[model samples]
Target: MGIRSTLPLCAVVAGTAALQIPLLSPHQQAPLEAADKTKPLINSSALQDLISGDRLFTRAKKLFDIAKLGEDEYNHPTRVIGSAGHEGTLAYIYESILQLGDYYKLDNQSFPAVSGNVFESRLVIGNSVSKSAAPMGLTPPTQNKQPVHGDLVLVENEGCQIGDFPDSVSGNIAFIKRGTCPFGTKSEHAGQKGATAAIVYNYEKDAVQGTLGTPSPNHVATFGLSGKEAGPVLEKLEKKDKVDAIAYIDADVKQIITRNIIAQTSEGDPNNCVMLGAHSDSVAEGPGINDDGSGSISLLEVATQLTKFNVSNCVRFAWWAGEEEGLLGSDYYVATLPEEENIKIRLFMDYDMMASPNFAYQIYNATNAVNPNGSEELRDLYIDWYKDQGLNYTFIPFDGRSDYDGFIRGGIPGGGIATGAEGIKTKEEEKQFGGKAGEWYDHCYHQLCDDLSNVNMTAWIVNTKLIAHSVGTYARSFKGFPKRTSSVASSAYESEAKYHGSMLYI
Candidate 1:
């Protein structure tokens, strides 16, 4: 298929107010409210009511604080995969749900993922050295930890095609602007043109934190520079001035084991499961509170509240890891799952960014789905909820930019909501959503500033309510929802699918 496309609890851990997470048990079961036969069926209103902004914020704060408990060698405050922060996130989710007793079956599915850690990255131009450079994820490090020294040659037209690289680029560093193509593609093109390295600068003011999708033989060591840092070099190049530079990136890219938390309601029919997911890991730069901590905590709140009632269809919640690097955790789960188990999933909903400060109620536009089995219905359900609530909403393409990509590729219909991401809010959206038209939905997205202050509490609560509504509706019944059928082969999506986050588009 081608797509287009926190409850606060305070606990002291390591001098930080982290969540009071308990030790994980292989399996634990205790009687909960779902056991009573007289319990009422889950409804949207009830489920939504259980979602408290105060509670959610509390939890979000705790998650942010936990990220401060770094385990990586750098020990920065990050919840990136293979770090203590991520493990703490997993433990917190397990302990939170454990409070619900035996209502759900929880499992931590472990897998190894190739994670890239950039030890050093910089762009040295004349006497000016900018250490604000970051290596694109999954990109190869400079050979022998050596810097690539060459004259900076600006690639024309965003450097998406071979023609963009001038003959003068041979043995030089390709100075490219980010847009229109994957960073990998640009790097590959630069390598093909005999460029010693590629330096892709962001179009936005912020530093470029992107991925090359995967390692490629044609890719040379690549680095990214923010618009501010690259401005002087760009001005010099535009004026036809000779700008010599040194690009260096020392990174360690290796496969490391991580785990995904999968929990399903034990009370419902497992044959027809309504699945929801949010990435548990953050980018290495910061605590991913708004990026996905909002979504992760939303699921936790919903799961805890759902213990009050039973469901007809099983509701499964997943905290996927390695989402920031790529959709590695969810992809691994879908790839390893047996077809018999796979077919049992009725629909999958992904909630990635739920609380962009300058937010919009953007639902996943399932109309562009590669496999439209039950996707539109899922989208319409959220749309209908928004309409009923008298909220203005818009659509974002199903561009295989989130965790929903794997399920949709497997012919399982998928849909969900997002506040928004790096996309600048348009004037029309501004009128509809009451946010600044020219600013990014979340200005702090993927940056160290994406901490507790980055979130919009109002939008977070509303989006969480929407998630509850959708989860409750699907859990109660699948009436009128289309049955799963053979979708376009997974191979069909291989060519066009974008594995990176929402910011990068084909």
Candidate 2:
């Protein structure tokens, strides 16, 4: 509950000159080609010469190398909040933008985020142990390593509602099956029932993994167990045999301030800005290269290459921190934006997990009525983009998951692309995007294996090129896009923001 911070965030210069630039890492040694430096201001077709699969792959490798340094030097491998890897990633991105000269106004808005890391955590059944078990995101460390043991009590299929938890679950661990609710809600209900702890088993084949969405006093300490682990615990309990279990969770929670890197072209109409954003932090496990490194670096490279161009409408790029921690960075930015500042956003775009290993040509399905007025226009833009390339594309609903949640809530039209996450791919999706069916879009979605090799270079190249195209298009014109409104309330976001009983996000 250590939440408030009095420290003023470091106001990063937006489109400002550099004070000092860090030396590039060894892996980031590619020389700026003569064409790269002198490339004339252009429209979207310039993507052909500026970015390619090879370049993106090489840059991603360099990003992985940078992530490695966090493990080697700072002892935190992944780019999670307050980790060395995350700090380094931010610095690398900042330097990349600073190197672009006077092309954009550069600003780093630093703010405190309630972020933490697990020191030592575990969940073990009386017999079989699932190494894949992960602590929920943003779990407070109060229950550190103190093993809580109980006869596993299985609530209804989903222990989401207070009524779903039985009175008998009091003084025991509530073994809840996950569905139809936020993981935090399940934990909150079980805790309200006087349960010692809560264990949420995945409704899907994979292990249950996700955050409580935000810090809540009502939520008790909880751990995620795989379906494999939960099945046995339930079976043993059903057979009247003792199904004893112990869960150990320890984390250090602190109010740590992180930066949001925002850079915008100076020549364009500042009153009407087009925004692009991607989270800069990873999870607690590996160097979340593909989970976000691909997206983060995609914007970085595009921002660098964009320096040669003159934009008509200001193009603002943001590298947000604390997305894996529940979209805190971007959420804070949007929530605190002044009336004038909020209205300037012509439209907002988010790019996250764009290069999942088993990639998909997925666009945010803003075509639905749940989205803001102009979301469909953004969706159509991406549909036309992939269709023009003869690529098979599909629509991913505009759920309040990812960094765009805040923008959508601020009444801004939002759309972006994703390459899928932990969800399993159907045979139909395989036919559409062409990878092994039945496999997770990113086999290493949030695990330690999400390293340098996790990206599908084809997806990386195409999606980033699409980003370049969008930036160039919007940077030059907002002719067909929806006009900015004065009000800041988003009906779609308000409907979706209180995700009390939704089980779809992490």
Candidate 3:
């Protein structure tokens, strides 16, 4: 899925006033400079203090300041792609990179991106209205269309094939399970069965806002429901109960072209490079502070601080645009990179939502059956770091749901971290992270309220430190990861013992 909605949503280590980030044009490319090879590359301890919660907060305030500005304000509140505020965001990072001067070579890869919105989504089950109803992305406008009604019919097994629909489904609402195929495919099948509307329940988990993948007349206006919520309703229908429902969706469809920023160290092994990424653009509704700004700003702070030392392996930092538009920017960057250049990337780590009020420490599960090779090592780096702190952590699959989607598809080893988003927190998680068990991880997920207050300070601070821990360790030495045969590093070492050697917090 493209950067998801239900979708939702960094910083530094000091006084942000001390940052003398130089401004650079969006299209400007900084010339590469020779690295002063004489300076020794700093180890984890040499740079630990630099990754400060205070510092992270300082830089994070800059983004909030930008996002607080009104639409006409110089730094607009919403960093929607191509918006003035988004431009402000780009300028901030460009300047941050430019501040490093000769330390990194900068490349601004621009792409034509697309995005749209489901303007209104409403539902009424019997006499009660549902506040949880949401329109599937790419759902056609219901403004000029007929409202959905009649008996709700349950479709079997993921509803991928036309046979899943029965004669009774015609002229009714199709209740489908989310599995096997794209949401669009299921919805299309419902239409093929003559259903006026479609409701796809989350087969294994809680309710989620989903995309139909694309627009199609074959699709009936679709709504995603959670299994917990659907179980009783399904049982009632099975008992031959009369359950009437309605589904209405209207949308605003348009497009915008955007770019992804890529900056690389001037020094270090060119054959083997470590890549760090975060989405720079927010969703259509909110400022996306925790969604990605936490990750973006943290990387900026780290990049600026990184100039203070040298690195044995090249480190590349990317601020991806149009991520909320389905990871468009990152996908475009990967698709266009020459195959030879693509092979040069030794590892890719993505950081999307680094702050959620009711947060869970999520590390992408790289050892899972589906993950690409080397992904496990990337995940272990953070899991081990969290374990050392005696903190509880959980796994998030590196499936194609984020900016890392493209890299994983291209066979590059990739993994990432997320605080949490629209998913409801369980009681067990509540005991661990401490917040309302039934509430959304980020209550304001994909909404205009996903601003400064939506973040959990403790989660924000800890994750930022972990990011620095991973970046600094990899930049100094690949260690636990395989050194490319193309690189000169002769010996392979493990960082399991030295991973936290320099951190002051732990």
Candidate of highest TM-score: 2
For 1-506, candidate 1 gives per-residue lDDT tens digits of: 00000110111111121121222221111122243577787887998988899999999989988898774554568898878888888888878776676676667777888777777777787778876677778778776778878999998989898999999999899999988778889999988899888889977777886788766778888887898888888999999999998888888777799988877776655556789999999987788899899999999988888888877666889999999888988888888866766777788999998999999999987753445478888889998988998999999877778998888777778889999888899999999999899999999888788899999998999999999998888888777888766564354455556445543533
What are the runs in model 1 whose C-alpha is more than 4 Å off? 1-35, 71-75, 124-134, 144-146, 151-195, 200-209, 216-219, 224-244, 489-499, 502-506
Steric clashes per prediction: 13, 11, 12
Candidate 2 lDDT over 182-281, as tens digits, reads 7878888888898877888875567766677667776777778777766766777767676766777777667788988877765555566789999889
| Candidate No. with top lDDT | 1
Please report the TM-score between candidate 1 and the true structure.
0.80
Ranking by TM-score: 2, 1, 3
Q: What TM-score do all the candidates reach, one by one?
A: 0.80, 0.82, 0.78
Per residue, candidate 3 scores C-alpha lDDT tens digits across 1-506 of 01111210001101111132222222122223224556556566556567777776777778877666436732336787767667778877877787667676666666776555666677777777765666776566553654667788888777889998888998888988876567778888888788888888765546557776545668777887767777777888778898899777776555666777777776655546679899888776778788788889778877877788777666789999987766778878888866656666777899888888889998877652354557778888888889998999988644456777677667677788898887789999888878889988888887787787777778877887787777788777665575332221111211111111001000
**TM-score comparison, 2 vs 3, better candidate:** 2
How are the candidates ranked when ordered by lDDT, highest leading?
1, 2, 3
Summing lDDT over every window of 10 consecutive residues in candidate 2, give the lowest-scoring window: 24-33
